[model samples]
Target: MQLSGCIALVTGGGSGLGAATARHFAASGANVAVLDFNAEGANAVADEIGGLALQADVSDEAAVSAAFGKAITHFGSAPRIAVSCAGVGMAARIVGREGKLSFDVFEKTLRVNLFGTYNVMSHAAILMAELDPLADGERGVIINTASVAWQDGQLGQAAYAASKGAIASMCLPAARELAQSGIRVMAIAPGLFHTPMMEGLPEEVTAKITANIPFPARLGEAREFAMLAEQIVENPFLNGTTIRLDGAVRLPTR
Candidate 1:
């Protein structure tokens, strides 16, 4: 789809991958909405890109609905491109030295990563369906973020892996259902990237993770993720699939 003059909504647009995508979209002439739980961060990014910043929690239906409403109020229409990038990661073995993982921890991860994506996508699709179709009867595109850990998780990533795996597993069915409405759905399962999730790790641990990347031998950049999002939006035929942006790196079982 042509991005020029299009309206785009990016959840988790306050930081990391979401922020990068928001900036890219704005640079491409799209009117962008930056939505995040961190209102300050969202506002900062929005100011930089001349877009609207909405405070919202993707897991909270009311908050997400309100934010979308705000975006429509400000932009004069529903966003044609909606990217669900709001998620969290939790590392814990289902059964380890700590014994059984806390149910709360597991549930939180699933709620934010899996349900949150669904929440935003559902609302976005509803709005997109109401909009007039573009040149090729295309209503809009939805992009979701998954992780390579969903497929090749190492030790202590049960919650994170399961949440991401759910996203990857749902892409095709969701895309198929939305196809009738001219709405394309796709997912990106990213490997190690330079995001806040990795920033919390110790230096040595981060370096070890980077060493696993066979080619570039480093962490993926947020811009790389944004580039793929742009491509998925532009390539109409690329639907109902999950693309792995890991630089050919697959994690080993530890």
Candidate 2:
């Protein structure tokens, strides 16, 4: 869809991939709205871009709904593009040392990563459904964040993998269901990007991780993810699939 002059809502816009996407969308001429659990980060980005900042937990249905409402009210229209980048990457083994159950960790991971994405997508679809269709009868597009761990979960990533795996798994069904309303659903499974989560890792550890990537031989830039999102938005034929944004890196079993 043409981004210029259209409304776009981005979750997790405070930092990382979401922040990059928000800025890119704004620069692309979309009236962007930044939503994040970190009010300060959201405000910072929004202020920088001259867009609206909304603080809310994406896992909370009511909060997500209210955030969209505010964006709609502020922009005078529902978003034609909604990108869900809010999620947790907490890692824990299902059976930890000495058989300590990590059910709590697993549950929270799913709550934030899986359920959070669902809440945002659900609300976005509803609002998009109300808007009149554009070319090809398209109303809106929804992009979700997944991770490579979903497929190659390491030793302590059961929780994180499950959550992201669910996100990737849902793409096709979501796209098919939303097709009637001319809303497309797609998921992006990123391998190892230089996101906030990777920023603090020691150089040696980071190098070891980068060694696995076939080419580029380094962590991906956040802007690269944003670029893919922009492409997905403009290309209507790309739908109902989870695209791997990894640099052809199939992770090892740690």
Candidate 3:
């Protein structure tokens, strides 16, 4: 489906890749909705992009409902593209020298990263199913954020890897079920990228991290992630799969 004049909603759009997506969608002539936990950050990006900003924790169903409703009221329609970028990062070994990892950490990560995606995508798909399909019989596209660690997790990434792995695994089933309704589900597994998640590292530390990437030998840009999201929306045939935006980098046990 063409993005021009479509409505796009991006979760965790206050900053990072999500923010980049909101901006790109606006530039593509889509009415954009920016959802994030940080109201200030969300407002900032929304102001710059001329999109609606809503502060809502993606894990909270009530909050998500309000956000979507507000966006619908503002844009006069449900979003044609829903991008899930709201997630948390965690690092913990099952058994460390200090002690066993806290189950709370694992639970929280899963609740937000996995459950939150479900909450948003489920609601968005329901609304999309009710919309009139395009010439290609496509009503909407749902884009989820995974991580390269899902499959090639490094040391101390048990909790994070498991959560992201579940997201990656969800694509095929969701697409299959939503296919009848003309809604597509897809996921993106990004490698190390220049976002707040990868910030605060020393120069050498950052250098070492990107050294694994075979080409370009640098961190992926947040805009590059957004670029793929736009491509997925425009190309209706690309569904039911997870695309890795990593620069051909595979993490080993490090």
Best by lDDT: 2
Query: Which residue pairs in candidate 3 have backbone atoms (N, alpha carbon, C) closer than 3 angstroms, thus clashing?
Result: none
* lDDT for each candidate structure: 0.93, 0.94, 0.93
For all candidates, the clash counts are 0, 0, 0
Is 2 or 3 the stronger prediction by TM-score?
A: 2
* Minimal lDDT window, size 10, model 3: 93-102
Question: Candidate 1, residue 148: CA error in Å?
Answer: 0.2
Q: lDDT value for candidate 3? A: 0.93
What are the per-residue Cα lDDT tens digits for candidate 2 across 90-117?
Answer: 8777888899999999888999999999
RMSD to native for every prediction?
Answer: 1.1, 0.8, 0.9
> On residues 2-89, what C-alpha lDDT tens digit does candidate 1 reach at each position?
8889999999999999999999989988999999989998999999999999998899999899999999999999999999899887
Candidate 2, number of clashes: 0
Error of 3 at 114 (Å): 0.5
What clash pairs does model 1 have? none
Writing each residue's lDDT as its tens digit, candidate 3 over 100-158 gives 75688888899999999999999899989999999888999999999999999998888
What is the descending TM-score order?
A: 2, 3, 1
